[model samples]
Target: MDTADAIIVGAGHNGLVAANLLADAGWDVLVLEATPHAGGAVRSGHVTAPGYLSDLFSAFYPLGYASPVIKRLGLGEHGLSWRHAPDVLCHLLPDGRSVTMNRDIEVTAASVEEFAPGDGERWKNAYRDWQDVATPMLDVITSPFPPVRAGLGLAARLRVSGGLRLARRLLLSARELGSELFRGEGAKLLLAGNALHTDLSPEEAGGAVYGWLLAMLGQQAGWPVPVGGAQRLTDALVSRLVSRGGRIVYGVRAERVLVARGRAMGVRSAGGTDWRARRAVLADVPAPSLYLDLVGARHLPPRLVEDLAHFRWDGSTIKIDWALSGPVPWKNPAVGRAGTVHLGADLNGLTRYAAELACGELPTEPFLLAGQMTTADPSRSPDGTESLWAYSHLPFRTAWDAEPVARQAERMEDVLERAAPGFRQLVVARHVAGPADLEREDPSLVGGTVGGGSQAAFQQLFLRPIPGLGRADTPVDRLFLAGSSAHPGGGVHGAPGANAARAAIARDRALTGDLYASAIRAAHRAVYADR
Candidate 1:
């Protein structure tokens, strides 16, 4: 049997991040990946054409660029370079008008002003408020739940910014926030469209939180792509881990977590290989998979098993990638400046799409979130050509039969054509992945949910993955949830992984190990005391 100080299941970015941190702290770390490659959803491949690079799942990582966790990893030294498009984003309206966001505050303000008379100043004001709280706010977000110190800093800043009023605003639906702040459809579409990036609708409560966070991050740190390919980011992480003497095994699926008397011992692979862990087992898979599939129902608290039964997955996803003959011929030239684009005619269209999903109906017209990879990173394809991909969310139970999915992809292409004339003509090659395909490619996506689980307020913070302490510690001792299913949810940022690593390290300290473990166990008992 192989052994290590820490065994991380899944070589997804989060798992890799945890491995690197553990190794850096002088713990022997081992990573197990079911796939042959490392980058779970963050991979890139020439699926469209030999010369075109398409991100397998996620692209344009604004969260990663703004993440102090990722920043502190010093991935740049390990060959990670970021590339940003000239303009940050664009939302194409039904009337062919483009609302673009630029890194330059004035430019973004001017762009919004074209829609409403005073929206320019409103945009500036919003940006100013974001700047004031960006530091502490991000700290609180990326920290463990209950972020006492960071929350204090943010609370102080918020008092000066808008106090409890601002807190209420953050909890507003994207529609409400937009309507209250900007008297224009353009800015509203921008915010609502960003909200759709998650499995959220414009009218969903707390949708404004995601929309505003991404929008502000885009303004502060332009949505960036790895220069060569999304794979480069993974390579950088793997490089850093290997440099620190971490070992990763490919094609190894962790089938069961070996627990002894309520403590995690290690994991047993599908091939019947038992790998021991001296200290901890950090699972970067989804929450249910860890608690149900790996650990088994018998090992978990009855309440936790019941909670798993009620676990709500986010919506399914359908993604299409195209290798274009040339740049997208947007009817409006300003749309081409952006690396990322949102397609929803207006706030009503967004509402309609979300409503359809809620009713378990496949939308005839979907709201798309797309990325022009070549525009963001020129090296993605041949000069003058584009590597483009778009994805839309649907009901979780949507059937993904090949023919229907093909038809849906056609609908997406139709949406694109409406925004850019002759879009079909520019497609040199295309690839489509429906729910089944996405899940097959990355099981962590579970039913094609890219955000781990639902980002709804009920499933967030302390209630995340069940109503627990919201740290990485699991009911099974020495086990941690180091994936997006934990607090702070999903994105390219490695907060969940970083938090888990810190927790494991703190609990394993030579002088305080027993004390920390005792406290964590007591907290878990308090949370899981009931039936």
Candidate 2:
């Protein structure tokens, strides 16, 4: 039996962040990862030819760079350097036009003016409104729910009517917001395409918030990539955790959490190895995996178990990575300057794509979120050659056998070819990952559903990952879920893990912790009393 003050399952970036923070506070921490390597989805590898670094899953990190946890950890000091493209993102329109989102607000606004003359000023005004509330908004999203401080600060800034207006805007779908705000396709595509980054469609309520937040964040922080590769970010995080006296055990699958007297004691691996925790156990796996699989339905309230049955998962995805012989020969040369590009979709096209997904039908024209690694970081590949990666959402529960996956990859290439005429010719070698492959690589991305689960309005805020208060504390005492499935769901931001650590630390400390625990218990009872 192994023993530690705390045991963390999953060595993903979020788990690593939690371990670092906990170990820094003098708790002995042990992280068990099922994969041989850390970083989970935030991994970089050479899937194609030599001298080519491909981000196996997630690539660009706008949320990572903007994350408060990352800022506090100062990953830059631990050998993580960021590289930004000349432009943050480019949305290539079907009609041979494009809109680029630059780091500078004025520059981005100017690009919006290309489609509709006065809409440039509208873009500027919308961004200004975002700026006024950006700090508080980020605070609310990243903090533990019932965000008292963030709520108070935002209220102080917005007052009553402004807050109400903000709430109304949050309720709007991406399509609605775009139609209401801009008359041209450029700005509309920019917002709608970003919304598709998640599983949400243009028409889904609460999709507008994602579009607005991502676009504004791009303006604030130009969707930067790690200097070497996505692995560099993970390397820095692991380095920091090791420096802080935390140990990570690789290739250990946690089969079940060891519980005693309704309290989490630690975890037992599939090999029947027991790693005991003197204080707490933090699970960085998905909500379903943590609660229903490892912890088991027997321990949870009956109602919570029933709710888990209906827990919605985001759409699966098919990703394609290529080792290009040269840069993508975009018809619009300016598209080459962007780190990220949206391909084969305008506003209406994205809506139709979403509709197809809703009907569980493969889209005829899938929208692609493509990344040009060399454009952002020249060292990602050999000079003049580009490392390109793109992914499009698939219908949930789609059959992802090899043949189907290959067909989707080919379709994705077709979309890219249409956007950049010579795209197919430039591909020296390619790698494709279907939903099944993704699940095999990272179990957290169950069914290839990213962002934990769906970030739809019903699954957001306090209602995320099975209701109750929007905190990291789980139904069982001394156990916490610190994954993307928790509040402030998804993205590379380590808020969920950080929040779990904070809650655990608060409970371990005396005085105020007692009152805090009491309140949490009361809230939990109230939420699940009937069950």
TM-score of 1: 0.98
Q: How does residue 204 of candidate 1 score in lDDT?
A: 90
The C-alpha stretches of model 1 lying farther than 4 A from their native spots are: 510-512
Clashes, model 2: 0
Q: lDDT per model, in order?
A: 0.89, 0.90
RMSD of 1: 1.4
The count of residue-pair clashes in candidate 1 stands at: 0
Model 1 lDDT per residue over 133-178, tens place: 8999899999998999999998887775576877898789999999
lDDT of 2: 0.90
TM-score of each: 0.98, 0.98
Q: Write the per-residue lDDT of candidate 2 for residues 304-350, one digit (tens) a residue.
A: 78888888889999998899999998888989999999988778889
